[model samples]
Target: MGMAMTSSPQPPPPPRRRRSRLQSATTISAPSANPKPNPKAKVIPLLSDVGRLQSATPTPTPNGNPSPNPKGKVLPLLSDVGSNPSAIDYYSRVASNLAGAGRLGDFLIAAEGLRAASGDAGFAARINWRLLSRGVVAALREHGLPHVLEFLRDADRIGVHATVMLDADASDAVAAACRQLLDERIMAEFVEAIEALARFFVKGIVDPMDVLKIFVRKRDPDMAIRYARIFPHSQLLLCNTMEAFGKRKELKHALKVFGALKDQLGGINMFACRSIIDICSHCGSSVQARIIFEGLLAEKITPNTHVFNSLMNANAHSMSYNFSVYKHMQEIWCPS
Candidate 1:
């Protein structure tokens, strides 16, 4: 028991550790196996990194108000573009070509930078018939009519100007295209355009009947006549053509177009009414002309002095004119 007690006491508080210099050096030199991750770790997200993410991360809504990014910095906008040689070089070439060609629209489309640069909406609405015509004429002078025609085929109004611009030799193509449109039922869109083109082809203002003749020969007569009425200045052309047809004894065609013209004009013109009379007289359909004259008298459009003179002249030849036109004219006249 005495020995045990002495041995236990001999262990005495193992000398209060004064860290050995070697131990301290070892601790300082050795790397720890269970090291802690850095607080400023790359695992933390950046604002740009957050922005670049799509659909994976939920956007923050803190109390319905999101926290702002902690690491954001403003970046300069397009600062490097000025120094980009390729971009500048490309634009320089395009600009020179545009200037030489007087094609500012094309130049802008091909420029270094622009949004909404290409397509019909960008350039189509900006042009008018006259300016477009001048440009087309220049292109034809430089290139040829075929190229201009090809360009116009894309837009109906442009097609019209092209029609006028094309030489008569190209009429086969123009008429063929127009006929194709008629077949496809798209001619309504192209009708006025075609008429304008026809006027250009015929030189000077085209008679409405002439346009009708072109339209009717290829498409429906009623459809052509209807479209002719819509054209500005078509009335005089229709009226004159009707008169000329009557003189040439082309009775059936004259009467057919005349009736259509009458309806289009609301059947109210004294000029149209007189043409009917003359057509009937020459075709021996004076009876029909007489019927129309009586209807006009009933409508209170009394024969004018000039109309009466023509009536008197007609009557001098035979009772046919006298029995019809003169009788109608004399009834409306207050004897001088």
Candidate 2:
């Protein structure tokens, strides 16, 4: 095999063409001597035609293109797209499609068309509160809290205060959602949202205490009580609310409040004193509350058996320097 091995011959190269001196001296010309300027070329009008057109035509946006009909045209932009068949019919056809697709940024151009058409006259009337609320709700669910809040503020600046508050008509559903979040302890966010709504809907006229009561009725009684304290005028309601606490074995609250009120008044009705004595007897603690009863009597009120019984029941076990006080109490009740 080594003896028969031989190198293969190389193939010949093709001959190169040579140019003459005169031909070499001549230069190549451009594709066209008089090139037509682009028919749709953009010329900077010191004031932007785009800017000028911006006032009238729906400016083509990026997310989705806008329409090009004369009614919705960017005159220069329209000519540009029409000049090239391949270019988007952005001004003519694409704008409507974009708005149809719910691309708000794109549809804003169409909105421009609409705003321009009505000269913003029918805007306030046509874009009603119901529609506005629906839009806001959609924006909130679709975008987020900040977005909705921003819209709410803007609407308020314009006069949508009534509408925003009226949305409480949807409170049942909204409140249910808030409750679930509260239970999960994810309330910070929802609380802010609700607070924003409260600020918008009930800002000046609403009593914070009243609002808290509503929440208490719906969500937290203790919190409601604390908030209720902020409203000094809630005394009447709070007094009546004691029965509710008593039913729940929270009589301490009722007694403490009523007792404090009695003490603060410095003098109360004999019937009122008797009622306190009865409460003390029921709780087996008239002696602990004796100072109040004594103070009432010192003010010329008569102490009854109910009052005497209250003292004995609460003080019987304790050693008293005046065992005579007990004798007097017994005789007072069964005086012979």
Give per-model TM-scores. Answer: 0.40, 0.35
Candidate 2 on 87-195: residue-level lDDT in tens?
Answer: 2223323333342343324433433443343343233333334443444455445765556555555545543342344355333334444455555655355456555
- Give the per-residue lDDT digits (tens) of candidate 1, residues 64-106: 7655665543322122225543433333344334424635335
Worst 10 residues of 1 by lDDT: 112-121
| Per-candidate RMSD, Å | 18.3, 15.0
Question: Would you give me the overall lDDT of model 2?
Answer: 0.47
Query: Clash pairs of candidate 2?
Result: 66-95, 67-91, 67-92, 67-95, 68-91, 68-92
lDDT of each: 0.51, 0.47
Model 2 clash number: 6
The worst-scoring run of ten residues by lDDT in candidate 2 lies at 43-52
